[model samples]
Target: EFYTQPVQSSVTQLGADIYTGDNCALNTGSGKREVVVPVKFQFEFATLPKVALNFDQIDCTDATNQTRIGVQPRNITTKGFDCVFYTWNENKVYSLRADYIPTAE
Candidate 1:
């Protein structure tokens, strides 16, 4: 069904919009109920810094589930880091990309 309302979705100023769901349509088959929509996000810390991260949210229809997907910095290492560390004078920082996946499970 076409949304009677314009679904409001936003990304971080630095986050990359990967794929917005062309998810469901008025012609959607009953078996084709769910599809995964993910936003790829990247953050570059010019100055090495620590952050607590959260992607945005999408409201759902009944009997649906959504989840955060892709590689989370917090998942790979003890500390979720964009990069290992920075050298004082190097001026090189960290860059990371993670996919936020929301799906119906």
Candidate 2:
């Protein structure tokens, strides 16, 4: 499986539009099945200008037994996170692939 238990994820922004996520699905269909689901960030009051992303575990379903997974942020042009994951029979697929890139403001 390419997902973790209790699938949930979040991405926090850092002044410079530093977006992020904890999951990315790719190449699991008739063609390239790259999917980047945007997640909301966890922000709190009185917090010192910082943000974080959290992903609740979820299956990264693919039409093929083999697949690639990770996270992608639009903030970083031409950048993404990717990883290969093998499938297990009779079980939901999931991957811990995630992407993150910090830029100077």
Candidate 3:
């Protein structure tokens, strides 16, 4: 038999913190920025867990522009990790949601 625990989740904003400077071009059609949002686990696990991200809401200045967005896990630890939200050719992002689960198997 297998058992699972409750999933931990969080929401973060884009184009904020570390997304400025040379990493991103202001008021430009072509730009790439990476924003790191720190996430803390509700319950610590013995081993590193897995995480997932999804776009809840996205806002951009250029309606005609095809924006690109992505998310990944960084600095993974048993306690928590940072969720990196990245985008290219986009102006802004409203919100992003992240979910995590702890499982060694």
Candidate 4:
């Protein structure tokens, strides 16, 4: 399944508009699932921005399941950010949300 949502800018100066979602099946194969969603920013920032991945919820039903699941930002740029979702079990499904924010410095 695929999903996407537009990110509105609370600060008008930023003028942020981006689309983020997963591009893979709910049930993935045995290995790492690369989550690279496309981002559309109206304006540029003073420096390279940062990508944040937050796992709001996750469900995996298996008594003997010994799989580890996690999501992290692998790369970040003005265009978009590359996130990687990894899982050792092939039957796990995850729900994640991403955000792009300007750098502190």
Give per-residue CA lDDT, model 2, range 6-92, as digits (tens). Answer: 855443343222222333233232433444434333333232222223333445554456543333344322222222233333323
- Which ten contiguous residues of candidate 1 have the minimum total lDDT? 83-92
Q: What is the TM-score of each candidate against the true structure?
A: 0.20, 0.27, 0.58, 0.52
Residue pairs clashing in model 4 are none
lDDT tens per residue, model 4, 1-105: 999898644322232323224434434565555445455455655457665555554554334666566666565665545556555555455444544444423
Cα displacement (Å) at residue 92, model 2: 11
After superposing candidate 1 on the true structure, give the runs of residues whose Cα lies further than 4 Å from its correct spot.
1-13, 24-53, 64-105
lDDT of each: 0.28, 0.34, 0.56, 0.50
**Backbone collision count in every prediction?**
1, 21, 0, 0
Q: After superposition, how far is residue 92 of candidate 1 from its true place, in Å?
A: 42
Worst 10 residues of 4 by lDDT: 11-20
| lDDT sort, best first | 3, 4, 2, 1
Most lDDT-accurate candidate: 3
lDDT of candidate model 3 versus the reference: 0.56
Q: Write the per-residue lDDT of candidate 3 for residues 1-105, one digit (tens) a residue.
A: 999998975432222222222323333445786667787766676666655545544444546666667767788787777878776664565444444443442
lDDT for predicted candidate 1 compared with the true structure = 0.28
Give the higher-TM-score candidate: 1 or 3.
3
The TM-score between candidate 4 and the true structure equals: 0.52
